[model samples]
Each structure stands twice: as structure tokens, then as C-alpha cells.
Target: MSGGSKLWGGRFQKPTHELVDQLNASLPFDRRLARHDILGSLAHVTMLARQGIVPLEDARAIAQGLRVILQEIQEERFVFRLADEDIHLSVERRLRELIGPAAGRLHTARSRNDQVALDFRLWMREAILEVGEGIVETSQALLDLANEHRDVVLPGYTHLQRAQPLLLAHHLHAYVAMLARDLARLQELYRRVNRSPLGSGALAGVPYPIDRAFVAELLAMDGILENSIDAVSARDFALEFLADLAIVMAHLSRLAEELVLWSSSEFGFIEFDDAFATGSSIMPQKKNPDVAELLRGKSGRVFGHLMGLLTVVKGLPLAYNKDLQEDKEGVFDALDTVALLLRVLPPMLRTLRIDRGRMHTAAEQGFTLATDVADALVRAGVPFRDAHEAVGRLVAYCIAEGKTFGELAADELVRFHPRLAEIVFPRTVWDAVRAREHPGGTGPEHVARALEASRSELERTARWLQQERQRIDEAFARLLSEEFP
Candidate 1:
């Protein structure tokens, strides 16, 4: 159908070509939002009848028809037609088919502009909650892994070279920190997405006595949007959501990359469980970290989705535009990508094997205790810069002699710095790993303290997630009672 000769056909004479209809249709992707569109229509129709814009009987029939359609959709029995351009048009056309003229009254005071705005906001509000829950689940998995491996020593790296020794729990908790920030961002996005934009018809307030706040409450929204133009034009929630997804994906990609590297024979710091790995076709010994690699690869796709939506919305003159139709695909893709990662990553992480012996051996070989040695010199009254330079020369001499810094004999240490004494050198590798006792240092005591702090953070995050989920569930229940009961 032509844009004008379709459902809203009032000003045009010609029919749209089949090719044009297929090209412009969003029903293929946006059908996922069908339930939200129907819910919004039900609320709008009820508000219309209460305002005397539509008869009460018509509103009742329209609501019944919508309820039937929702059931069919939930059961996967509803047929989606390409003739309808998007979910809004598809559901309205179906309503008309079911309830005849009563369906016509359902759109009396609403425009597709504000109607779509409301539908998208409602969908995103729910999606943000789901994404937040998924993040929390993944965070819990990381915390569990951290708790299991709190004492496993690993080499921490800077510039891809060993910098110090650290507990594996500390490394895993870094991701938990990133995910915590992601959760906070999603919560803030929920605050913005919770506003209702139902009364902003097209680009202006509708000429009806409908109560916007009543519809907002029926939808369980935090508030009604204030400005008609801003309401219809606002897509900041979508952008914010995509941006947060991009950031979380970046963190995931970093973790994935490390997993890939650590699983290599050169590192041998970790091994993937058979379920999360794949064997090469020709190489019998090749069990690959394909899951981690795929996770890393998918990060680019999510980022591309974010940039695609950003490009689509960057310069559009608002109310709504044909260009905005491009918005759903990217948002849906980004949501799918994040949801899939959230579901898959925790299982993969939980199953992976940590080669703690290899990690410890690597940590021991890198002279990761050089910083502790430098600090020891500092404590012995040497200025920090002087100690650092002295350590640097000692490290160079050790490398030239094919030795670790720990191999320097107490008497041999005097060759590099004559002020050194026989009691200066650490007697054991583990002693070297534990010598720097400063707070937040990688010393044994500090690592234990860090582990405790991480455990406390994990508990706090779990409590927050539980409370947030309960709050959302209560809001959804209130919406159900107000709108459906």
C-alpha cells in the first residue's frame, strides 16, 4: 500500500508498488514489539472513552479485541502481514479486522508519531530491566569464580608485559566492577525510558480532553512527557542504551581477548572446557578458544549497531521521520547481541579451567617482584627515583646473565648497588611475592584484603539487583491490575 492509501489513506489516489511496500516495511523486525503496541493502544482507548472522545462500548470492544490479539501473539498464532508497514499499523489493522468500526475509534486522538514513541519507550523500559538482570547474573558468575580462586596467584600485566603478581580473584573482580557500572547506567536509562509520551500526537499536543497522567499511570510510567515536540522527537533513551551496550561489550571483548591469549600454549594460563572449545579440522592437538574468539568478534558487531543508530538519528529533523524506521533494527540487534552474550558468557566462564601452576610459574619467571625490591630499597633510605633506577640496572644485568631478579645472590647484589647487604635478598619466590606489605599492593596480605573487599562488593551488588527486580515486578503488577483487570 502507498503511505497515504494504506490505513491512514485519506489524501492520495495511487497504490504503492509491491517493491516499495516490502522495502519500507518494518513489520519483519518490529513485530517483536507487538505486545507493547497493543498495551499502549488499550490504555489510549480507555483514556479516550473516559474523556468521551469514544463511546464506552466501543472502547470495551476494542480492548477485548486487543486482549484476543495479545493471546494469539503470545501463543505464536498471530499472522504478521507485510502490507502493514510496522507493528503500530499491523496491530491497528488487525483491530479493525476484528472489531470493525470500533477499531477506528481507538486512534481518534493519537498519531502514529506519538503512538510509536510510546510503544518504543514501553519496550525499552522492559528491555533495560532485562538487560540489567542479565548483567547481574553475569556479575554473580564472576564473583563466584573470584571466590573460588581467591588465592591463585597470576601475573598482572601492563603493556602486555608482566608488571606484578596478583590474585586471579582480583583480576576477575575487575570485570565485576565494569559490569557494576554498566548496571548503574542501565538503571539511569530506565529512569528516562519510564516516561510516557502518549498524548503528544504527531508533533503537538492533541486537541482532546484526554488525561495524559491517567494513561501514564495505566502504563505504570514514572511520569508523562511534558513537551509534545520533545516527546515525539526524543530518542535519547535508545542512544543511551546502545552506548551502554557498547561499553559493556568493550569490557567483554577485553576479557575475551585475555581468555584467548591465556589459553594459548605460550601463556598456558588457562584452558577452556571442551564444551566451550572447538577442535581444528586437521590439527589433532588444536582445541581452540573459539567461544572467547566469537565473543570478541561479536563485540564489533554490537559496536557497529550502536554507530548505525547514531548515524540514523544524528541529523534528522524531528517529530518523526521515515529515517527513524531504521532505528528499530539496530536497537533490536544490539539488544540481541548483549542478551546472547550475557546468557552465554557466564556458563563459559564457569567451565573454564585455571592453570594456577602455570600462572604462578609465569609470575615467578618474570621477576614480577622487581617492584618489591625497589620498594625495599626505598625503605632502606634510598629515594624512590634512585631505587627505581638501581632496580632497572639490576634487571638489565639479570637479563644479560639469563637470570631472574630473584636469582641475584645477597653478596652479588652489592655489585650493582654497594649499599646492599647480605640480608637484602628474599630467600624464596613466595617470600618475594609477599614482601611489599603496603595496602592495595599485590602482597599476600593486600591480596587477601582485596578479596574481602570484592566479596563485600559482590554482596552489595546482589542485594541491589534483588531489590531492583522486586521493584520492577511490583510496577509491572500495578500496570497489569490498572490496565488489564
Candidate 2:
């Protein structure tokens, strides 16, 4: 064994093995956290100065040095090193080389354990805000689409078979409901992630008479992670985040699958914008829903990333371990996937052409009004089960005769049950759609009310996201400013 940097090697007899160095390095992916690492270092060093743990002059020098590195990274001028293993070491390595022995004091009372944890939380806080905004904007787009097509009625499906009639706004609003819950999950996760883990030091708490609250406040976090071992070892925040992302992506995939189905000639419920669709290489006639299809496919990776991270943390014991290094890559992948899909989808949806005529035609053909007819029978004193049975028999008879519900004459209805003849069935598709008058029903009046409610929810969600962003911005300003209060 031979020559390695003396930074962490005072006790070692040999240089780190070349293969091990390459294998252990996270620089390829985690170099993106350089600014976050420096931000964490700045907070830590500022705390050190505040508490007189390090000389004021040395703390000032370290602070300025870390700020300079942060600027370099932002400008894409910083040189990342594989030998440094990860961002924390790389920043400290560069700091030592930049500011001489003053840089040596930068690590005082801090370990890469808690330092990296703080940096990661900072990064994910911003990430959550960003992804939350994406979810909000996506919901807003759905609201806009629903608002645009308020009167369009489409077939609602069960087991991929048209089972009832629903307004297109109702369908779009269903996704908005799912996305609203997703946004709520992201908001909750942000609070969980916003707690600072910096003062936990390595595994045991640092013994420098340092104030964890001071550092946490400076970082604009909720509070400190009280247990040192849990502070550095816990990755449930990442798991929770991935879980949120996977669910959102699953929702997106469902919408995407519908888009794929709807854009086809067979369904023709929607048509993709030219920019949002693709053509086949072999068949010039083929206009494929590739973008929507791809988003649907992308859910696999988000799902895989969630499972990957869950597996990584499942058996790990308390306190930090190198196994924890397995965490960020999966998280990063899921975050990137979610962010990209959300960004592309809103615009694509805004430009899509809804085929109101096709949707209306499909809704009418499905015997969706059978429920309305059954309900009508119930109103006419047919027992509820008998009404359902009566409707089922009527539908089977119509299918056997190659006729629709609309084709059955009033006189023909008496054969199913006398109650069927007594009831006034809706004559046209619109008549059938309008007959289902109930709150949250696909009736035009109800869908309009739902649309307004979704609009209100979208506005509220947007405001909530803006407040979250403002809080982060204000915190960063405090962290970067000369005043520590």
C-alpha cells in the first residue's frame, strides 16, 4: 500500500485501491449536490462562529471560501473529482487547497454523516417545492381543459366496457382530484424533509456546545432531528417522496393510457396535437400517440426507483452505513422522471383536440342510460333489485336484436316490466345525460359545479405552492445574508 490523500488517511497504511476508488465514488451522479453541500457547510461554519467553536476570523475565511466554491459550481466552473468520493469531500478538499489551513477548521464539530444529510434535505426541500409546483400546474391544466369542455359528455367505463355516461369535465376532474391528493402528499413530505439533521454529527451528537436550533433556523428548517443515530440513518423521507412521485406518475399513466386509447381511430375521443404525436417509419398512415405512450411507459422507472430505494433501506440497521450511499441515485431518477413527465404533459393536454361528437356518440351506444332507466323504474315503484334485473334483461334483449336503448319504443318497454312502460325514458343522448340529476353526477349542471370546485381547488393549491416557494426563498436569503438573526 502507498500514496493516498492524507485527508482521511492518517490511520491508513496504503493508498485506496484504484478499483475501490472508482467503485466507491458517487461524483458521477451526486456532483449536482455541490451547491447544497457548500450551503450546508456555510450554515455549519456560521453556527461555529456564532457559538465561538471556531475563531471568528477562521469562520469568516471558511464562509467566504465556501461561497466562492458555490459560485464556481453554479457557473459550471468547478472541477469534480472521483477520488473525493462524494460532494462533501470534494468541497472540503477544494476548500483546503483554496484557503490554506483556515479551510482545515471548516469541518470542526461536523462529520460527513450529518453534513451530507443536511445537504440532501436542503436539496430535496427545493426539489419537493419544484415537483409540487409541477403537480399544481398539471392540475390547473386539467381544470382549464375541463372548463373548456364543460358540456362534452363521454362514456364512463367499467372493465374497459362503457358502463355509463359522464361529462368529459367529470373525467378530467377525476384526475384533478387524484393530483390534488398528490399535491397534499408533497406538501406533507416537505414538512417532514424540512427538518435539519446537521447537528447529529457522525452517529453520536457533536460535543462542541453547538446549538442545533441555531443551525436549523439558519437553514429555515422545521426543527432538529432529535436522535443523532436516526438523524443520519433515516431515509424514510426519500421513500415517502418516491412513494408520492410513484402515485402521481401512476395517475399520469392512467391519463396517458386514456390519451393513447382516445387518439386511436377506433376511439377517436381525442386527437393529439401534431407536435405531441408521432408517425410510423414503416407506415406513413400511422399517427401514433408516442408522447402519451412514452409517459405511460416512463411510470415503470418511477415505480422501479421506488422499489429500488425501498429495498435498499429495508434491512439496514440503526445509525449510518455505507449502504446508505445506495439511496440518492434512485431518488434522483424518480425526481427527474416525475419532473419531466409533468412538464411535458400539461402543455400536451392544453393542445389536444377533444372529439365531442365521438365522445357523445360513444356514450349513447353503451346503454349507459340503462342505469337511468333502472332508476326511472325505481321511481315508478319497481323494487330496486327488480329494476336492476329489468334493466339487465332489457339490455340483453336490445343486444340480441341489434337495437339500442333509444330504439326501443314506449310500447315495447312494457314487455320487460309494466314499470318500464310507465316510466318516461330519455329520448336522445343529451336527454339521457341530463336525466341523471344528482350532486357529483355526470349531468351537465353537476359537472359545472364540480368544474368550479376544481377551479377553486386549483387556485388554492397554486397559492399554497407560492407560499412554500416564498418560505424557501426567504430562508435562503437569511442563510446567505450577513445578518444571522
Candidate 3:
């Protein structure tokens, strides 16, 4: 269909060029939102009928036609055509074809502006929940690893140099903390996205006596947009959702980068399972962390999507512009990118291998116990500054002699600092680890408490997620019953 031959083509005298039609076609990507667009249309039609704006019989027929379309789309029988600009127009054009003139009434008191806005919000609500589930799954994987490796020690780094000793469990749980914040941000985005904008036709309120709250209820939105201009003009929800996704992907990339580093032969700190790694084409003894590398690389694309949308919406005026049509491609790209990452990361983590012996050995090679030695001296009435300088001298001496801190004798320590006594020397790695008994430290008791707390938080988040899913399902069920009953 040429632009002038399209449904809203009354004012145009000439047909739009074929090049413009191809350029404007969103059916290839936005077609993924077909179900959401149909659902939003059903809710709007029901509200129109209840308010006597459209005949109840027309509403019933439209609802029935949309249900059939949804089923066809799901069954892979529906063919989206490029002549239709987007899912909104494509579904509307099909509904008109299926049910005759009454299908035209479905667009009453609505514009492509508010219609697409509603579709995006509905899609994002579901997308955020799915991403949250991915985060929960990843958290559980880390929790399992932490439980299995609670007693294993690893070197914690600063500027890529080993600076301290910590339990492997403690190190893994740090990711859990980062992900918990990510989950909270996603939930917040859902709350903001749950508001309805259907009554905002184009950039102004529709003249018809439509009940926006009733439509909001039908769509299971928490509230209605109070101002019509603000409703159609605002892409804040999209911006916020994309920004949240970018942040989460960044955290994931950081973790993936570390996994890549740890799996290297130079570090020998980890050994990923064959399922998550790949063999080099030319090297006989190479297992690359290909999954982690991909995840890290994909993060740049997600960030680009976020920035692209921000730039598109930054200078637009207080109304729906054709520029708003540019919103879908970037938002769709970001959603797809994040969803794919979430789906793959959990399984990769679950299958990856941990080299506990290597981690323990690396933990001991550096002067990771220097803090413990300094603390021991502090307890022996030596000032902390003095103890720090004393440990620094001893570390330099050990480096020159090519010996580990643990290999130095008590007399050797005394040679660096005369104030040092026999009790300052730790006999084993476990002795050094157990010495850190402060709360939130990597001591055994502290790690156990943290594990319990993390388990409790996960349980709470799971309950909230289940309830939100049920709420959305029930709202759709009600919409179906009201129209088809």
C-alpha cells in the first residue's frame, strides 16, 4: 500500500514513493510486539463499549477477531507485510479486513502515538520481569558455587596486584550484591512503566467521552496519564528502562571479563568446562573462554542502543513527532541483547569449573597475609604505622630472596623489625584466614552469616516475582472474559 492509499490517506493527493515505504517498514522487528498491540487494542475497545462510545456488538466482534489473529501469529500462520508500517498498523489493517467496517472503530479515541506507547510499555513490563528472572538464576548459580567453595581461599586484587586474601565464597558473593541492586532497579522501572497513556490521542486529549481509568484497569495499568500532552510526548519510561538495562549489562560484562582473565594459563585460577569454552584452531593446548568473551563484547552494543535512543529523544518537542518512530529499533535492540545475555550467562556459570587448589596456591604466593601480620603486631602494642612499615620492609626482603612471607622464620621477621615477637608468625594459610574475625570480613563465621542473609533475600525476591507474574496473567484473563463471555 502506498502512503496515500493507506488508512489515514484522505488528505494526500499523491502516493508515497516505494523507497519511503521500505524505509518506514517496521514489520520485521516490531512484529515481535504483535501480541502486546492486540491485547492493548482489546482493552481499549472494551472501555469504549462500556462508555457507550462504540457498540457492544462491535467490541465483541473486534475482540473475537483479535483473538484469532493472536492465535494465528503464535501458530506461525500470520504473515506481516511491509506495506503496514508497524505492528500497530499491521494488526489494525488485518482486523479491519477480518471483521469489516466495525474494525475501524477500534482506533476511535486512539492514535498511533498512544497505541505504540502502550504496546512498548506492556512489552517492557514483561521484559523486565524476564530479565529479573535471569538475574535470580545467575545469583543462585553464584550462591551454589559459594556454598561449594566456602573454605577455599583466593587472592583479592587491587590494580591487578594481589592485595589481600579472601574466601572464594566472599569474592563470588560480591557479584550477588551487584545483581541485587540491578534487580531493584528493574522492579522500579516496572512500577514507572505500569501507567497507561491510551487516552492521550496524538498530543492532546480525545474529544470523545472515553473512560481512561476503565481502560487502564482493563490493561492492568496502575494509573492513567494525567496530562495528554505529557503522555504522548514522554519517552522517559523507555529511556529509564534502557538505562537500567545498560547498567545491568555493564555489571555482567565486568564479571565476564574477570572470568576470561581467571581462565587464562598465566592466572590458572579457573578452568571452564568444555561446554563453555572453545578450542583454538592452531593451538593444541588452548581452551578459550568464548562465552565470556562474547558477553563482554556484546555489552558495547547494548550501550550503543541506550545512547542512540537518548540522542533521538533529547531534542524532540512536547508532542508525538515522526522522530518518535525511531524509538523502536534501538529499544528493540537493547531488549534483545539483554535477554540473550541473561539466558546464556546462567548456564555458562553453572557449567564453569573452579580450580580450588590453584586459587589457594595463588592466595599464598603474594604477601596476602601481610595485613594479618600487621594486625598481629598491632595487638602486640606496636603502632599500626610502624607495623605497616615493618611489613613493607619484610616483603621487600622476601622479594629479593625469592621467598614467600610464610617461608620467612621468626628471626628473619625480627631482623626487619626488632619490635616483632615470636607470636607474629602464622603457621599456615588457614591460621592467616581465620585471624580475620571481624564482622563482614572473610572469616569463617562472617561468611556463614552473609550466606544466610543472601539466601533470605533471594527467597523474598522470588516471592515478589511470582506475584507480579500472576498479576499480569490475571489481568489478561479478565480482558478475555469480559469481551468473549
User: Per-model C-alpha lDDT, please?
Assistant: 0.81, 0.84, 0.84
What's the best-to-worst order under TM-score? 2, 3, 1
Clashes of each: 1, 0, 0
Model 3 TM-score?
A: 0.95
Q: Could you give candidate 1's per-residue lDDT for residues 10-77 as a string of tens digits? A: 67567777887888888899898887888888788878888888988888888888888888899998
List, residue by residue over 1-485, the lDDT tens digit for candidate 3.
11244446669777667897787677888898898898899889888888888898888999999998998898999878888778888888888889999999998999888888888889889888888888888888888888888889989899999988889888888899899999999888889899998989987789999989987887778998788888877888888988998998899999999999998888888888888889999998888889999999988988998888899999987787777777878888888888888888878887767888999889887788888888888888889999899889888998999998767776887897776656555656777778777877788888888887987898898888888889899988877674442
Q: State the TM-score for model 2.
A: 0.96
Clashing pairs in 3: none
Q: Write the residue-wise lDDT of candidate 2 on 326-436 in tens digits.
A: 889989988888898889989999999998988988988868888888888888877899999988999999989999876788787888898776678676667767776
List candidate 2 segments past 4 Å from native. Answer: 1-6, 482-485
Looking at model 2, report the run of 10 residues with the lowest lDDT sum: 1-10
Model 1 weakest lDDT span, ten residues long: 1-10
- Estimate TM-scores for all models: 0.93, 0.96, 0.95
